[model samples]
Target: MNISGIDLAIIAAYFIAVAVIGVVVARRTRSGDDLFLAGRRLTWGAIGLSLFASNISSSTLVGLTGDAYRVGLAPSAYEWMAGLLLIVGAFTFFPFFLRSRISTIPEFLEKRFDARLRRYFSAITIFLAVVVDTAAGLYAGSLVAQVFIPDLNLSVFIVTLAIVGGLYTAAGGLAAVVYTDVLQAIILIAGTSAIAILTFGQFDFSWSAATQALPDGHLSIVRPADDPVLPWPGLLIGVPILGFYYWIMNQYIVQRVLGARNITEARRGAILAGLLKLTPLFIMMLPGAFAVSLLPGLDSPDKVFPTLIQEFLPVGLTGIVLAGLLSAILSSVDSALNSASTLLVLDFIEPLRGEKLTPRQGRRYGTLATLGFMLVAAVWAPLIQHFPGLFSYIQAMFAYIVSPVVGIFLVGFFWARGNAQGAFLALVSGHGVAALIFALVQSDIIELHFLYVSGLLFALSAVLCVLCSQRFGDAPTDAQTRDLTFSQRDLTPEETPAAWYADPRFQAAAVVALTLLTVIVFR
Candidate 1:
């Protein structure tokens, strides 16, 4: 791929703009709450855009496009399923989360169950956020950077990207992450939309030309139960569970929602994110599908995204797309850095000390922690080359790990009888089941999709949560369940009545309808 001066200018401008935003926001970041939760002043639009941007990381772009090239559109289930699940979260989970005023997702566990669950889940979250999510994003960004600039070293690229993104995150906390994410989201959507249009234009923008040229099932979102990419049953079972954990429970993603000004803003932001989630199927995934004919015989599926940019995009547009890729890398890395540091300071440090830090102290520690995690992730990012593909490397672990966490959270929410002992036992026994299943599958003694494994693990955990709550402990007091449990208030409007069009239920319904329509069209 040849580089042009205009592309360099655009990419340079993006970097400078992000740095300025970080420094400016850092000046306003005065307290712990301001650092971790944006002083609880985020609006719906910022929350929505940040959620989408942080999630659609460089790894996501490369992995989704690559997987679509390798195994039809079945890989898109993870993308679109997020839309539907976000709607579910808007109505079911956001209310409790916002009402509780929890800084981290793990804090909610402590509120609902016990401190042990909080600390344990926080540890797990910190590991996944930094070691897996942040590191992989940096590695993926390096891969994309190398595509355009072949001489770029992996470690050098990783460190440069990390320092650029991390400096702002450490300085401004969640505000910087969200503000930068808003800019990144625009670049990402516009850049990918351009690539999609250019790819489709290759076949005179004919959908049939693109699909018919490929093998059967290439354009289909639904696949047979025996399909290797994503079986239909996994779509129904495993996808939702995974989506629930990522969109609703993950600290990095949920941190933006936690920053929203109010429940209405948070719910509205969730609906906006759901609508945005639908775009990847067309803009990102479909272009990869189109690449099956547009640029065939690639050495690897991972090359699909870069190859498309190299072959199809012109000078100025290439820079914008590359900037978008950079945007993705930074957004995911920064979100993870901020959220992981938040968990360490708020969830672990403060509690262990038996006293809350002053707001100034909190902000200072949070900044140091963000930079510390940033260094750790930068070191680990390049090490991913020793592992399998990025998508599988991340998703396989999540499949086994998230099911137990999701199980405990859902059980604790809906079932008032759920006790701390049951939640603990469920997590312990559930992971034991996961380990056994993982070994059996690895040894070829069993053949089950990871998604199916997720479903099975969830069932066992839920059952254990119920039984142990009954067998070992009494029901929690009404005081313990207050505002934390499921209730009519969760379903009700937070503010006074708004116009019909402004209602969250109405907006959610529209998003849901659009999501279902998308599935039907591609089914």
Candidate 2:
């Protein structure tokens, strides 16, 4: 893995540009809202790009490709299934959040249930975002840095990533993150696409040979009815629950949508993100499959992409690819930093103290919180090295935390009889069930993917909340009507400008291009 001077130069230039952009944006940020939520004025284009960039982290670029290298395209189920869920989110979930005009998702919980639920969710979200989510990003970034600069110590890599991501997030917040994300997304697409192209060329662009050489299960879009990864049955129930929670309710991801200028823009942004996600099969997953043919029996699956860069790409191109990897890492890290701080400052500190801090005061606290999380994440980054698969680890962590929260939100929004007490109890009990299952499985007391356990717990929580709410009290007359009014608003028109969705030219062109690419590759 001898990186050339040209590669280092290109990578250095990209980081300089990103840092400059962050500083420039910081100068324009007027308050905490502007910093954290982009002044709630982001257009559909910015939101859409930001969402795509934030979601496609180094974990996806490096880890997904590695998974594909080891297990084939099966892991792409996460990306492809997301498209269908995005449609559901655009129509079902977007309306309620937009109409309510709330800053944080936890705020909605408080309104729908009690402050206790809000506090619980807020604390959980912040801890996960800072400790788990941010740690993943930092760990991945450090791995990339280690490959690029092997002589550099791991602590240096951690500090470098933490400082760069922290400075930008603390200074400019979401506005800076979104702006840089757009640029980072472009770099990611171009860099990954270039690697894929070069890798395919090495195999003479032969899918026939590639598919034939791979294992029997590698090419199958549908996994076995009992497969652990896809598990045919799980797709019907498991994926939808996971996707809805991630794109719709998860604070780190949904925070991008919450920053949209209007409901229409948010919906459009979400739909576009779904569409963009469909590309992972080619860019991330396919590369890994191709890596199987090119770099067989590699000791670590996570090293696939870097190995490809070292083998196929020219000197300058290597720098560009590394820059893209850095972009992916920083985009996710900064987004987590900004969102975690927003949750801590808005949901927990202000409410607990009964103190109405001004936006400036909020910004000060937010900056401190962001730095605190960065320190915590830097510590946890090293632990991920012990995990078997990055993709599974990420998904499993979210399965326990996100499923119960989604269950509560759905019941609160749709079921009139879902009282605050029921919502609170269900959340606690659901989490308890998930924890018990996780402990049991780790200790060999039971055996199943945490996804299955989470799905069951989610169902139990939703059903119990509904039943308990009904048994305890009469449904308030205002509850059902208010819920319907909030849920049924025409989100498309309300959020988007008329031309946004009505303009069929872009969609048609994108469809045609994708069709052509699919035929060219798979044919």
Candidate 3:
């Protein structure tokens, strides 16, 4: 846990360089478009890397390793299934998103349904992304910060994370977020990949040897139907539903895809993001699996990652990895801050004002919202330390909020018979189901796994949507329905790139195949 002067210097320099990038990009900000969607000019590569960076937060890096150490690889389904989900999004959701020419995902709801729906969706997104997800990131980062500097105050780390992430995000907006996220992605991958390699070396360079001390089913991707953590039914049903909500619809993630230059760029960007997702199974998850041998019997699974970095990695190398960990923190924090601001300004503020603000006014309101939300998240973050397990606590809350929304989003998009009344009831009933199940399960009155519980909630919501739509409401107006339904016309242009390898369809299909093959191999 002791930090060398070299490590201290490396970490300090990383922060300064990121701040400089924020300042430089702020000078280019001339409109709301530039702030929120990167002026809709990002290329596939930047978009892909930014998505990866924003998503692979400190919580994921630490929590995945920790979860694997304690409970085997059951939780990895959430990570791996996302690639398949992104493929689905690329083909289905992103087409609608791009064609709508909207800045926020909730705007799509407003266009298809009504402003009330938009505000409702946006409000939920802000609470989850800003309050829950952002606070979790801060808690995880501060947890790691304490490991690095035993003397560091938890509050200090939390506030520092907020100031660094919030200031840059508010100053330079999405363009700065994406560009810095790209840098964070590179550092994070390189640094973690090194640790993964070194971890295998601890077992004489043999995967078999590294996994020898693990629990049964520790390396398996598919668990039994009655598995305690991740039942096979849940893996099949719940994961995809949650994955769709996250990879396709979650504002924190989909915002990057929404910023791509065109349909071609967005599709390619999404595919590229899916490809990067595969790396975590090895770089993040396996390290903890191996740690069951290398660093055995740790007091808490959450401590496994830091223990590995502290013990095995040399000084300069540890510095790079530490920076990568902080990058993860900043990446998620800045992303959540920016997206939450967008939702507040575009969905609620502008609508309530009864007229659109000029670009300058929009930027000002967005900055204020970002700063305010950062304070709230920072204040609440350290409380997450009280949870039983970091990873499960985060995932469990998402199930309550995200599943119902996913049910409504998918139904609203695909089933023209679906109505606003149905959507409202489905959304409301979904959370009720989640709360009821959580209480029952926590009281030891139910044997259902959490993921299965999420699946149950999703199914209930979907059925409620159908029943209510059929009985309670009329069809969407022609104006709202136009170009809202899915069709062949939504695809990217048929013109082939000079190289077949460049085709989004080709790249995306390859990512999907690899994902399926991985699941089968691990199963």
Candidate 4:
């Protein structure tokens, strides 16, 4: 575990380079549009890389490996399923978002439904994103940091992460986040791929040897319906629902797509992200799946990534991998900070103001909001220790909060007969359903799997939306529905094939093919 002088220097160089990027970006940022949407100049390449980098958080790296170590490859379902969901977003949501020219995800709801619903959506997104997603990243990154430098205090690490990432996010806004995220994505891919290669070498590159003496279900993606870890039914129902919510509806993740210059760029970015999503199955999760035969009897599964880093990889490479892991933490945290601030400024504050603030004024407020939320998340991050584990903490939290939101979006978008009352009811009642399930599961009053519970709540929410729409109101005028709902434009031949590679149909086909291949190979 000892880091050599060269390794430390390489790590230091990464930090300094990141700082320089931040300063350079900060100088160029002035308007709210520049800060929030990267001046709407982001290309597909940056958007795709940023999307992947932001999503592959420190928590994702540590938690995916740890979950693989503890249970099996079940956790990789979240990663793989994400690719399919992103494709869904590319076809269904991407057109509406770019055409609407909106900044925040909730803004679409406002056009489709009403302001109250939009406000409600924004509140839920901001709260969960900052409290759950951002806090978890800080806590996870701090844990990984402590592994490399035992002398580093958790509080110090959390605060340092918040401040360093926050300064860039506050100053350069989405531009800095996306730009820095590209570097982060490369580092993470390179470093983690190298680790996977080295780990495979331990078994003479034989899958059989690496999986030797593995526990039952350790290499499985499918499991019994009643399986506590990840039931097979969860894969069919809950995983797709949650993945849709994350890839299509979530603000922090979609902010990259939102910043893309056009639908073509956004579509391309989404496809690239979907392709990258397949990597963790090989590079991150499977190593821990196979590590059972090598590094056994660990007290906690969450230690899998750190333990692997300690066991293999030469000194300089270890530092690089560690830096990549930390980059995930930074990218995710900064995305959350930027997004929470965007929701606050765009959804909450901007509407309330009588006279809109000047662009400079808006940028200033965004910086302050980012700093404030950064502090809140940094201080709150360590509270995750009270949970069972990092991955479990995130899964349970998302199950309860995000599923209902997804349900509302589903009905609100697809059903033209859907009314605002129904959408609002779905949002409120849906969460009520999810919360009850969460409580029952915790009290052991219900034996239902968390994933199944999530699926049930989402369905319940969708049904509520339907029934309430029938009762409370009539359908919107066709004029009111223009460009918001799926139109003939979505299915046109030009877009249908869209060069085969970029087409949503082909992208979805590839995702399904890869997913089936994975189940066949690993299950």
Candidate 5:
């Protein structure tokens, strides 16, 4: 791959601009709340774009395309199901999160259950963030950078990316992250859309031409019960459970929503993100689907995306797409660093000290934690190269961690009878089941899709939550149950929207309708 001077200049300019934005935002970040929650002043547009950017990491740009190349469109179910799930979050969990005014999702757990559950969940989240999210992002980004500069060592690039993302994220916190995400999201969408359009043009702008050479069922989002990629049952059962954990509960994605000004802002931001989620199926996944015809016989499915850029894109245009790819990578890395640090300082250190941290102390401790996680993830990032594929490695780990927590959160939210004792038992016992299932499947004693495993784990956890609460725990007092549990009144807006379209319900309905229309078109 030849690198043009124009392309190098463009990439350099992008880095400088991002650094400047982070520095500007850091000036205002003087406290823990400022660093972790953006002073709770974020609006709908920033929240929405940041959510979209943070989730669509470099691994996603590479993995989504690569998996689509091998497995067809079934891999896209994870991307689009998220839109519907975000709508569910907007109406259900978003209100609880906003009204409660908690900084971290673990803090919400502590309020609903106890400090034990909060710290437990926080420890697991920090581990996943560093080991999975940050490391994977660094690996994917470095992998792509290697494509452009073939001589660059993977380990060096991984460390370089980690340091760059870590420095600003440690400096300014969530404000820097979301603000830069606004820029990154725009670049990512534009660059991917360019590739998608140009790839389709290779088929003479005809859908039939694009599909004519592909395998049967390559365009379908739904698959048979025995399908290897994603079985239909897994689509219904496993996808939602994983999506709920990622969109609604994961501190990495939900922290921006927690930063919103109020419930209305948070709900509207989530709806906006839901709408953005639908675009990836068209702009990101379909490009790879089209590439099945445009550029066939690539040795690695992960090479599908970069190969498209090199083959079809002109030199200057290739630079723009490359920058977007970096944006996607850095966005995820920065969010993971910031969120993990937030968990370390607020959930663990603050609790240990038995007092609240001042803004200056918060910034000092938070910065130290951010840098520590960044180094740890950087060290682990290059090791991911040994995995069979980037996408599966990331998804497989999440399947083990998420189901039990999702089960406990849903049970505790809706059922006040679900006490701390049941919550603890459900988490521990559910993970116990997960470990056993993983071993059985690994030993060839049993066979189950990871998605099906998720569904199974969720059911086991939920039932245990109910049974344990009944047998071992007494009913919670009013103080324990009060606003922590769900109420139908939370769904009703306290004041009317200025216009009907301004209503969160209307926006949520519109996003849902769009998601269904997408399925109908692809199904």
Candidate 6:
């Protein structure tokens, strides 16, 4: 666990460089839009990198790797499935979101449903962002710091990481986050690939032996029909709903798309992100499997990646890997900080005060709010010691909250006959069902993975929204009608750019290549 001087120096250099970038960008951001959405001028490459980096947090590296260490490559079902879902998102969800020209996802809820739904979602998003998302980042970062600097107090590490994340996030907003994320993503990928390669070399074992040692079902990409993680039942009903909610509605992820320069760029960015997600198996999951061969019978699965870094990597390379881990942690934390601030200022504060603050006022409020939330998350980070599994805890909290929001958004956009009453009921009742189910599971009244619970809640909410809308019909108030009809029109050819795959030859080749790669890897 002893970190060398070179490793410490490399980590320090990355942090200092990021801080300088944030400070430099802060001076350029003049308005709330500039701060939050980067003046809506981010290119496809920046957006794509940001999306990839933000999603691949330390939780994915540390927690998912841990899961892989224990369960073999089965946990990678989430990462690999994300590639397919991103393609779905690019085609289906991107069109509507880009057309709406909305700043916040909750704003879309206000447009399609009602103000109450918007407010409720905003509140929930803030709570989750601060409690679950930010705290998780802090906890993971502190764990790494503790490993590298054992004598260093946990509280000091937690506070330092939170403040570093908060300062840059508050200063530069999404612009700095996205730009820095590109660099972080590169470091993370390179460092991970290096580790995986080195780990494999050290094993001096064949794939046959590794496969033999793995438990039955570990190598099965397609689980049994009733398997919990990728059950056949879930494919029929669960995955699409979960996909819609995560790719379309989740604020932390979708914020990157919202910052895209145009629909074409947004769609392209999403597709690119989907492609990038497929690499996690090689970088994170495979390394965990390699770890199983190297370091068996570890008490805590979460220690797998850190333990590997300490054992396998050379001195200078160890520092680089540590930097990559820290980058993953900070990238996610900063994104959460920026998005939570946007939701607080745009959705909650302005509405409550009944006064529109100037851009400067908004920026001030956002900075202060970001700092406050960081403090809260720092306090909450240590509490994760009580949780059994990081991935389970993360998923369980989201299952109850994300479904209703997802349902309301889908109904609002696709179902023209949808009404506010249905939206309200669907959101409230969907969460209610999810909560009750969760309580039952906690009390041992039932057995289900949180993903199953999330899928069920999502389906129930969508059905309820459709049924209730049909029953109530349109009771559109003047404001509701005006908002619904306002700026609603099909984009002309001039307005809508060409699709990402408009080139027929390139599109065909990409599809073939991706399909072949997927089949070969899984086979």
| Candidate 3 structure, TM-score to reference | 0.97
Rate residue 324 of model 3 by lDDT.
97
lDDT of 6 at 411: 68
lDDT of 1 at 292: 87
Alpha carbon lDDT at 98, candidate 4? 82
RMSD of each: 1.1, 3.0, 1.5, 1.9, 1.0, 3.1
lDDT of each: 0.91, 0.79, 0.86, 0.86, 0.91, 0.78
lDDT of 3: 0.86
Better-scoring candidate (lDDT), 1 or 5: 1
- Which stretches of model 3 miss by more than 4 angstroms? 492-494
What is the full ranking by lDDT, best candidate first? 1, 5, 3, 4, 2, 6
Pairs clashing in candidate 3? none
Model 1 Cα lDDT, one tens digit per residue, 245-342: 99999998999889999999999999999999999999999999889887788899989999899989999999999999999999999999999999
Model 4 misplacement above 4 A:
491-508
lDDT of 4: 0.86
lDDT by residue (tens digit), candidate 4, 1-523: 5788887887888888788888998899989988999999899789889999999998889888888888889878999888878877777788678878999999999999999888998998898788888999999888877877799889888888889899999999999999999999999999999889999999999877887689887888888877887888888999998888788888999988888888878887887898899899999998888778778899877788988988988878987898798799899989999999999999988899856778998898899999999999988998888888776677788888878778878787777888788888778998877777778888988778778878988888888998988888778888787777776565432344536675656666787688678878877
Residue by residue across 1-523, what tens digits does model 6's lDDT show?
7778998999899988898888888888878888888888888788878888988888778877887787666556667666666665666665566777888888888887778988898888888888888888778777767777789888788788888889988888889889889889888988998888888777564677556666676655555566766665565455556566666677888888888887667766776777787788878887787677688889888889988888889998998888998899898899888889999999988888899888898888888888988898899988897897666678788777787677767667666677888888888899888889989998999998666777788778889988888787675555564534323232222143366556422432464478447746764
Maximum-lDDT candidate: 1
The residue pairs found clashing in candidate 4 are none
By summed lDDT, the worst window of 10 consecutive residues in model 1 runs over 489-498
> Which is the better candidate, 1 or 6, if ranked by TM-score?
1
Tens-place lDDT digits, model 5, residues 246-303: 9999999999999999887888889999999999888888889888877788898889
Error (Å) of candidate 5 at residue 224 is 0.3
TM-score of each: 0.98, 0.93, 0.97, 0.96, 0.98, 0.92
